[model samples]
Target: MINQSELENSKEVGIITDISDKELHLALGLSDPTCNNEISQQDQNESTHDTSNSTAPSEPQLFFQAVGLVRGQYLPSTEKLGSGILLLDDGVIAPTNLLASAVYTVKKHPNLLESPQVWIVYPRVQVKNPPFLNFAIRGARLPLEGEDAEVINQSVDDFSIRGIVTYTNRKAGNFVIKVYRNFMPWKEQEGTKYKPHIFTITGVLPSEGLPCGQFWDLKVKRVADQLVLEDATFITQVFEPKKPKKGRSKRQGQKRKAKRNQSNPQ
Candidate 1:
């Protein structure tokens, strides 16, 4: 299960380009053509007999993109260097599971021009466990720099994101990747420079997090499926973007990993 308590301390990935929705959907596995229509006749009868059936369909296991992509590598978080990997925080009440800092590349589509199409420029926290997390969405633009992403003080209108289920290897040990919906232009936006600013997201704004964003009592729903993750609530910070520090000289960028390690800890 994707840990729900370590969002503030998880490893992150950043892509320096724009992505498309269709590609995202295909990547997230939402476009899988296979469907299990075969069902026992007796079970089907029972399903019809009971109208108030509250039992949820079986939840599929999900694989994170980073884990699937990175081999013989490690992920770091603010809390501990590659520790409690499975104990991820759900970005609520406290930011214990999300990325502490990151420099991702994102952008909006030209069609959605009037609506501020913002490329999410922050760390992309790869969800290691899907069963542990529920209700995922992608493509909802987090307001651009100089544009307030605040849900308070009437900052901006309510927003919706696009999500694509890329990989669903729910075979007991398989996981999936829900890509950023409509994420093609991201490639084009590479080197499309802009000022980097801080993005502060209260745990509450995220529905999956405990004490999630209460700004508008935002109701979260899966874009493609109704297979909801555990529906609990808590409060925590998800992503807090800050202005990117000025570039350091090549020497600084090329600092030895050993020196950086000294500052990190044993």
Candidate 2:
């Protein structure tokens, strides 16, 4: 039951699964995401039948049924601090810390909302202090400094939910959204993925209800002076909410500051 205008043009996260021994481990919320991958790696990352057709064209991006509408959604009003955590599956927490590693390279961004912000390195495994509930990405160009996104489960709706403001720090909290290019995701076969966006927030948790977003536009590389991100930290942003410029109408700056305070009255 999601379509509040496509979860407000989406960034809506929903998908839940947590087997254990057999290693299903892929939660989002409400459960429903289990692919054996036909014995694993979807059969060693399948797809290899070009029949001398010279298959090496590559280069063709654009897709998004729901990578959160190329990752763009906001609600703000939880408390803050990038408050998003949920990750409960451990055989030592491998599969790139939580990516569950099966072989992924999604590239959806042809126009409609643009999904695929870049900056991928799945695998953190520190599970002793900070779990994971800080899923972020908005026009992410890559190079995510400090890195985040852990929680596998604790019932934060299931996992990866959004609608923040829990105090401040969804990477400085507040809001940011962009990248609404529109539609993209092409893969006839290779795990059979065309577009599988799962989202359903009934009571907010896997990040507080709804906000599976991503769409950034940042450029920082200061290094010593600080500020950096070009390859690791879930880099992505596109939260546009800056429109406050309509002054001079308050009786023209109070009648030119009362005619310069009557020509200077100290």
Per-candidate TM-scores read 0.18, 0.18
**CA lDDT of each prediction against the hidden true structure:** 0.26, 0.25
Which digits, one per residue and each the tens of the lDDT, describe model 2 over residues 56-155? 2221121111121111221222553222222212111111111322112222433311322222221112323433112332332333466443321111
Q: Which candidate comes out best when scored by lDDT? A: 1
How much does candidate 2 score in TM-score?
Answer: 0.18
Q: Looking at candidate 1, what is the lDDT of residue 29? A: 43
Model 1, residue 1: C-alpha shift (Å):
10
Give me the runs in candidate 2 sitting further than 4 Å from their true place: 1-173, 179-181, 184-251, 254-266
